[model samples]
Structure formats: C-alpha cells, structure tokens
Target: MLYWFLKWVAIGPLLRVIFRPKAYGVDHVPAEGPAILASNHLSYADWLFMPLTLPRRVTFVAKAEYFTTPGIKGWFQKKFFSGAGQVPIDRSGADAAEGAMKSAMKILAAGELFGIYPEGTRSHDGKLYRGKTGVARLALESGAPVIPCAVVGTDVVAPTGKVFGQWTRPVVRFGPPLDFSRYEGMSNDRYILRSITDEIMYEVMRLSEQEYVDMYASKAKELTKAAKEPVEPSDATSSAKKAS
Candidate 1:
C-alpha cells in the first residue's frame, strides 16, 4: 500500500516530469504474473528512473547501505526506499551475490515484477557486457519470464565525477520477453541455465546497441582505463623551475 501510494501519488509524478524518460516495448511487460526486467546497467540514475517509467511497481534488491546510513537522512532514505518496495541485500563481498539472488527468487515466487541488471554493476563505459547466471537461476527456480531491457543516455546525466552532472533526456527501451520455457523441466542442468542466461544477454545487447565484450563490463572497464592512460612526461613539471 505504501509502495503504490508513492509510485503513483508522489515519486512517479515527480520523476516523469524531471527525467522525461522515453520507453519502448512497454507492452512486453506482462500485466500480471512474475517477470524479470533484465537490462544493461549504465548509470546510477537507472535505478531511480527506470521504475518511474513502468506501470507496475518494480522492486530492486538494493545494497544494504541504502538502508543503514545514520540519523534523519538515513531514516528518510530507508523509509523511502522501502516504501518503494526495495529489498535490502548486503553487498560487502562474495556473500552479497548469494544474498541478492535469494531475495530475487523470493520476489519472483510471489508473482511480482523483479528487476535485475545481470551485468551486475553500473557499466563504466556504457556498453553491454557478459551477464551473470543469477538471472537464469532465478527464472528457472521460480518459473518466471525474463524481459530484456536497455537504458540509454543516462551515463551522460551522471558520469563519474565530483559534479552530479547535468540531466539529459533519457531513453529506456523494453524489448519483448524471451521465453525460456524449454528449460522449465530441466532446471537441474547447469548447461540449461547458461544457455538461457546467454539468450537474455543477447537480447540486451541488441536493445542497448552497446559494444559487446565477451568479458564482464567491469573487467573491460579496467582494460579500457589501462589503455587510455596518459604517459608521464620525461621532463617533470612537478619540479620547481631551476633557480639558475
């Protein structure tokens, strides 16, 4: 009840105006039942903005920190995020993945919309990367369908920097849900999970139209940074001018 109140009466109205997000293939989202929204993650704005564009209340498994800050602001943040139906998962280490998937399965089993970014984290370079298998495992375990999604232009809105940066009109495209019903009875097969996971990632790549790297986007980002590094100058600018 609190979630829908904010979704329609408050946050939804405000974000629709501020972000003015554009959406495609919205009809692909099932009006009922459990479905997963799998997309390429490009910016922090993806979380706040994507749900605003959807008709149904979509829940994300958020990092526990969003709920644990100290004092009034923290109190407000926790309530706001919770009222929006977010699931809190500890993201401190290896256990974080296990914890997040556990929550994801719970949401899906309840016949609700579960939104996940299979790339795992925000894409530093705005490109589609290999997806983790958790999405597949969740769907297979819970008998849910996967809706591939793509969000564009938000990276520019909130790029990595001191500045919050400026808002650019963003576009979110929801591609049709690709059914993995073939794996319905074969959930125990790891190969089936991998195949289904890859299928979803392929659709995401097409929708986002980002450069596809076989490696995780996070790793590609590291290589990208390494390759673009500026060489140190042979003549050190740091040294004071010679007192000749």
Candidate 2:
C-alpha cells in the first residue's frame, strides 16, 4: 500500500514532473509472473528511474544497515526505502550471496518481479562490468525468464560517490526475455552459469551502449582505489640516500 502510494501518488508524480524519465520495450516485462530484471549498475538512481517507468512494483535487496540504523533518521530511512520497494538484507560476510539468493527465490516463488544488478555492485565508472553468475543461478533455480534491462543517464541524475547531480532525462530499455530452459537443472555447472551470465551482460551492453569491462565492478573499484593511494619509499632507497 505504501509502495503504491509513493510510486503513483507521492514521489512518482513529482519525479515524473521533474526528470520525465522515458521507458522503452516495457512490453518485454511479463504482465504477471516471476521474472528476473537483470540490469547494469551505473548509479544509485538506476533503481528509482527504472521502476518508476514500470507499472509493476520491482523489489531489490539493499544493505540491511539502511533499515537498521538507530534514531529518528533511521526510522525515516527505513520507511522511505520500504516505500520505494527495497527490502533489507545483511550483505556482509561469506553467506551474503546465499542469503540474497534465498530472498530472491522467495520473491519469485510468490510471482513477483525481482530486480537484480548482475554486476553485483554499482560501477564506479560508467562502463558496464562483467556480470556475476548468481543471476543465472536464480533464473535456473526459479524457472523464471531473465529480462535484460538498461537504464541510461542515471549517472547524470545521481553520479556515483556524489549526493546529487544535474537533472537529465533517464531512459530505461528492456530487451527480450532470455530463456535458459535449455540449461535446466544445470545451475550448479560453473561453465553453464558463466555462459548464461555472459549472455545477459551482452544484451545489457547492447542496450546501454557502454564500454564493457571484463572485471567485476567491485574488483575494478578496488584496483582504482589502490591506484590512487600514495606509495611509500622502500627501506633500501632510504638507506642508499643516507649512505650517499
């Protein structure tokens, strides 16, 4: 109820008036059924604009800390995210992946739309990163089709690592549903998972027209951070200078 109110009545109309997001290929989404809407992660605003363009409510798992924070701010944060169709999940530790999969499977089982960023994390840069195989496993395990989606210009609306960005119209595009029934019951096969994930990423790349990076987004971010850190002089260098 809050979800509908926020989307159609409260926040949705305001966003529409301001940003005027456009959507294409929305017909690709099933009217009523379980489906994975696999998309590239460019910016945090991707979730807002993509779902705003759709009639159906799209649910995505967010870090539990968003809902668990203390005090008055946390209460509003929890309600806002919940109204925005986000569910909180603990994203820490080795079991995080399994926990997210279970949550997603439950949503699919209930015949609801489940949104996932196959890249696992938002791209620090605008390029599309290689997708993780969890999306493939979800599709295979849930017997649901995977719809490749791309949201463009969200980075302009809300740039990564920034609070807000200049207003610009965002475009959401949906590609045809990818049916992997041929690989049914083979979700455990690492090779098959890679194949399916790659196929989905290819579609996203095509729709978004972003450069494709073979590395995971998180790994890319780590590399970028490492590059920016100051390097210390080696002990050998210091000794040689002192001796000289």
Candidate 3:
C-alpha cells in the first residue's frame, strides 16, 4: 500500500534521518484496538513526526481543499497526503461535520488508530488553544478511548504558514487513554461533549507545557492578523484627536 511504502521505504526513513524524531510513552498506545490520538496542533510537522513515533498508522481528517488544489504542487500534495492515509473532508457547515464523523466512525469501526487535533487548527503562536468538541463527539460515538498526545518542536521544524523551516529534533509524548464510556449514547449532549473535550485538552496541556489560550486557534490567528495589520495614518490621526 502507498501508506506503508511511503512510511517505511520512502519519506519515513528520510525524515528520521533529517529530524531525528523522539517519542515517549509510546507504550501507552494499545497494542491492538480502536483508539483516538488527540494532539495539540502546533505546526505542519506535527502530522509528520507523530506518525514516525508509532508502528500503526494514525489517520487524520484533512481539509478536502488540500486534495483538490490546482497545479503541480497541488498534485504532489494530494499524492503525499493520500499516500499518508489522510482522509479528506469538506470541513464546512454542520453537514461537513456529520460527514467527517461518519468517516472517522468507519475507521474506528475497522479498529484503526484515528488521529485528531482537538484544537481544530494549528496554533499561530505555539500556545495550546481550546479544543473543539468534535474529538469528544468522535470518542463518544465510536467508543474509542482518547489518547492525549503532545508534539514538541514541530512548530520550529515546519511552522504554520511557511513551507518548511530548519530541521529540529521533534518529540511526541503519548499519554494514557481517557475513557468516556460512561457518557455513552450522550454524544448529542453539548455540555458533556465540552466537558470531555476540556478533560482531554487538559492532559495535552500538561504534557506539552505550552501556555493555555482559551480561544480557538483559528480565532487567535485572526486576532493576531488583525493586530499585525498596518493602521492608516488617517485612522491614527482620528484616534489621536479623539483621545485629545
């Protein structure tokens, strides 16, 4: 299969040589069975390094747009991601969410390792952000234990918004799996979903030791962008006058 070939024969070997990834608590992963690996989103390399730490494949739900990109680069991206076993989903609207859950449930039903970034998006400033409830929803729906994972040094290796960065030793730490079977059949309960998501994020934060930001990563990025935007001279002068 393409995933195994690329992982064992191709890209995997090359990356290990370059980045020298290290992993801890790998024993926490179940030897066999369905489980969810919920990790903090720090950089693009998080996906790359996390897989290198495990024997079994960790399938993440990727944006459908990545597979549909136009041009040669898009083609390469599509091939690489597909070969890496990423599932593409629209990631829009409630319908898209439903579709993603179905896709994930299918993987779990087959007793596969499913990877998810509970933060929903990569952190812009390397701080852990609020996790989305989709992770909880998936766990509750699939009856899979959620394993909290912390990925370190990936932000430096492949920062968000940049193609790539300097090679660095990345570390992935897998924590004990969190079980939510007590909340069985309560996936529709929003409060329970939020509670479960927060519990998972707390373990990730403890492992990664990154500063906690209560806002979603996407919102944080938006606020950061807005803060960085240049203010017009007219607006500045108006503000100065108003202050006077």
Candidate 4:
C-alpha cells in the first residue's frame, strides 16, 4: 500500500530524521483498536510532524480544496495527502461539520486511528483555542478514546502565511487519552458536547502550555495581520459558534 510504503521506505524515515521531534507521552496512544487523536493546530508544520511521531497510520480530515486546483501544486497535494492517508472534507456549509464527523466515524468503525484538530483551524497566536464539539461528537458516537496531543515549536518552524521559514525541530507531546465512555449514549446533546470538547481542550492546553483563547483563531485576530497577542480569550465567539 502507498501508506505503508511511504512510512517504511520513503517519506516517514526522512521526516523523522529531519524533524527530530521531541515526543512526550506517546505511550498514551492505544496500541490497537480504533481511537481519535485530538490535537491543537498550531501551524502548517504540525501537519508534517505530528503523524511522523506516531507508529500507526494517523489520518486527518484535510480541506477538500487541497485536493483540487489547477497546477503542479494541486497534483502534489493530491499525491502526498493521499499517500499519507488524509481524507478531504468540504468545510463550506452548515452540514460540513456533520459530513466530516460522519467521515471520521467511518474511519473509526473500520478500526483505524483518526486525527482531528478540535480547534477546527490553525491557531494564529499559538494559543490553545476553544475546541469544537465535532471531536466529542465523534467520540460519543463511535466509542473511540480521545488522545490529547500538542505540537510545540510548529508556530516557529512554519508560522501561518509565512510561505516558508526555518526548519527548526518541533516538539510533539501526547497526553494520556481522555476517556469519554462516561458520556456514552449522550451524543447530540449540546451540554455534553461542550463538556467533552472543553475537557479535550484542557488537556491540549496543558500540553501546549499556551494561553487559552475561546475565540476561533482566525477571528478577532487577523491571521494575516502579522501581529499576535497572548491572551486567554478575546471578543471572538466560542468554538461551537465559530466551527459550526
């Protein structure tokens, strides 16, 4: 398969060597069965470095646009993402979240590790943003344990919108999996959704050790503005409001 071949014989070895990531609590990941890796999205580098640190094939739901375009870049995106096992999900409608959640559930149902950034988008300020309920929803519905992960130094290695930056080594830490079995059979409840999402974000915050920001990272702060302030939360809406 392309995935295994890439990991064992191609990209994976080179990535691990170049990234030289520092991992903590990797043992927290389940050795077998389906599970969800809930992580903070810090930068483009997070996409490159996180899964390399993991032994299993971890698949993230990438924007569908990445799979379509009109040039060499598009071709490369399709080839690499497909080879790396990422699924493309359209995030352009009210049902986008639900569709992505369904796709994630399908992965779990097939007994695979699914990666999700509960924050929904990259954090412009490297702060842990409020988490969307999709991760919680998937966990509730699919019975997958949620592992909290953080990729430090990504914001530095390749901060958003920079196009390119220094290839400094990044740090990746995997916290103990948060068991949501207690909330089993409670999917579709807003309160339960908020609670589980918050719980996962709390662990992410601890791992990243960044200030908490309740707003969507792209809001309140201009991702292209080139200036960022470290704060707990801003005037932006909650993750649920912003993500869905």
Instruction: Find the candidate with the highest TM-score and give its number.
Output: 2
Residues 1-244, model 4: lDDT tens digits: 8888877689877877877788888899988899999888888777668888878889887768778866999998888888887887745446778668767877898899999988888887667778888888899999889999998888877888897777778888998878889988899799999999998999999988999978766663665464454546544656656778
Q: Which candidate is the best by lDDT?
A: 2
Model 3 C-alpha lDDT per residue in residues 86-202, reported as the tens digit of each score? 988746447877778877888899999999898987888889999999999999989999999999999888887898788789999999989999999999999999999999999
lDDT of 3 at 243: 100
Residue 92 of candidate 3: its Cα lDDT? 49
Model 1 segments more than 4 A misplaced: 90-94, 226-244
Taking all chains together, the TM-score of candidate 1 against the true structure is: 0.84
Better of 1 and 3 by TM-score: 3
lDDT for model 3: 0.90
RMSD to native, candidate 4: 9.0
> How accurate locally, in lDDT, is each candidate?
0.83, 0.93, 0.90, 0.83
- The total number of steric clashes, by the backbone 3 Å criterion, in model 4 comes to 1
Judged by lDDT relative to the true structure, which candidate is superior, 1 or 2?
2
Best of the two (3, 4) by lDDT: 3
A best-first ranking of the candidates according to their lDDT comes to 2, 3, 1, 4
lDDT of 1 by residue, 1-244 (tens): 8888888789878877887889888899999899999988888778767777787889999879889999999999998989887979845447988889888887887889999999888887666788888899888877788999998888887775425767788888898887777778777788887888899999998898888877887788788889899977455554534532
| Model 4 steric clash pairs | 212-232
Give the per-residue lDDT of model 2 (tens digit) for 50-103.
Answer: 999898999998878889999999999999999999987645446878878887
Candidate 4: regions farther than 4 A off? 68-76, 90-94, 222-244
Question: What's the CA error at residue 196 for candidate 2, in Å?
Answer: 0.4
